[model samples]
Target: MTTILVTGGTGTLGRHVVERLRQDGGNEVRVLSRSSRPYAVDLRKGGAELDAAVAGVDTIVHCASSPGGGDEQAARNLVAAARRAGVRHLVYISIVGVDRVPLGYYQAKLAVERQIEESGLGWTVLRATQFHDLLVRLFQAMAKLPVMLVPAGVSDQPVDASEVAARLAELALAAPAGRVEDLGGPEVRPLDDLARSYLRATARRRPLIRVPLAGKAYRGFRSGGHLAPEHRVGKGTFDDDLAARFS
Candidate 1:
């Protein structure tokens, strides 16, 4: 049996990946956690434990990232560990508009992408749209404001995290096929509309005001840089998800 290893196995999406492999897939699974008892070994620090943990792994579902955490060291560590372990297939989850946007997170993701590309390992990179929960998290911190500030004329097509998780699992099971098509939600909506929906769900009444933001990230979004117009995943609508969240 091919033992699939999932990095950031305790994260929102990584948790789903591990569950699907163990519960739905019935595959031999190994999860890379910062602190898995019995101490699975620190891949970041690089040692005998890291080598031992990944020794027999056949595939890697790399849902790992350093967003708000690591700059690029996390990915480099994972790649080095995977190479030393001799993994066969490596599936990476990335953002849909990362190539077009100029955010620090995107740059970090790009660094990881390049590392995987040159590694000569059987690798697949799947780019997905922004997750609903990501939006919720962003709004949860700012929804309390009397007025929600958004980038004027920018748009988004937020997809469900669960759906993205499912797709990543699918990729983990399949052969590594270069860069897959972009995956997104059913409908595209303005940032203002998304903020409004978020406020409504949280029982807050706030006005959404759009203002011009200065940055390549803002410009990229304003120029349809975020929406994958051709790659609609159609798994969940934001409105439906809102209801489910409140229900």
Candidate 2:
């Protein structure tokens, strides 16, 4: 039986991956998280805890990330520890536009992707679009205001995190394919439209006002840098995600 270690196993995407892995009932799956839970080893210290978490693991599905900052250091520490532990495969989850988008969080993700590539270990990087739940949360936060301000000309193809998790599980079970095809949602919609949909679903009436953003990040998004139209492999749509959550 293959042994798999999933970092950030308690997180949104990582939990789904962990669930799918456990469904097989043939592999030994462990979670490396900051919190102490069942089958979990803490990696916050990043020394012996990290080393012990990776030791004897055949594959490491790296889903742990800090979007605000410090993700690069986390990735470096994990890669170093995995190397020392002789990990056979490493699968990383990244955003779709990390390479093209100029956002700080995207830059951090891209940096980690580069580190994984140069780590000299067998690896696969899956770049996925923004998650539907994130968009929903964003709209929820914006609904508090009189006018929901959205970035003008920005579009999004929000994929379901569960779909991404399933793909990650499959990749973890297979041989490493470096930088596989991007994964996007079923359809691309304007960010304003998405906000409107969210408001409608929740029965919250809010006027969505488009505001032009003058930054490299907004330009990238407006130019569809975060979209993978050709790689619309995900089946779930934003509406479907909303229904599942609310219904």
Predicted model with the maximum TM-score: 2
lDDT of 1 by residue, 1-247 (tens): 7788888788878888888878765688888877765435445575766666678888988876667757367667767788988889889998877788888888778778888898889999988888888888887777667777777897789888778888888888888898888888888998888888877876887777788989778888888867887898757888888899885
Per-candidate total of colliding backbone pairs: 0, 0
Model 1 residue 148 lDDT?
Answer: 79
> Cα lDDT of all candidates, in order?
0.80, 0.89
Top of the candidates by lDDT: 2
For candidate 2, write residues 136-184 as lDDT tens digits.
8888888889889998999999999999999999999999999999999
Model 1, poorest ten-residue lDDT window? Answer: 37-46
Q: What TM-score, over all chains together, does every model reach?
A: 0.93, 0.96
Worst 10 residues of 2 by lDDT: 36-45
Q: What are the runs in model 1 whose C-alpha is more than 4 Å off?
A: 38-44, 69-71
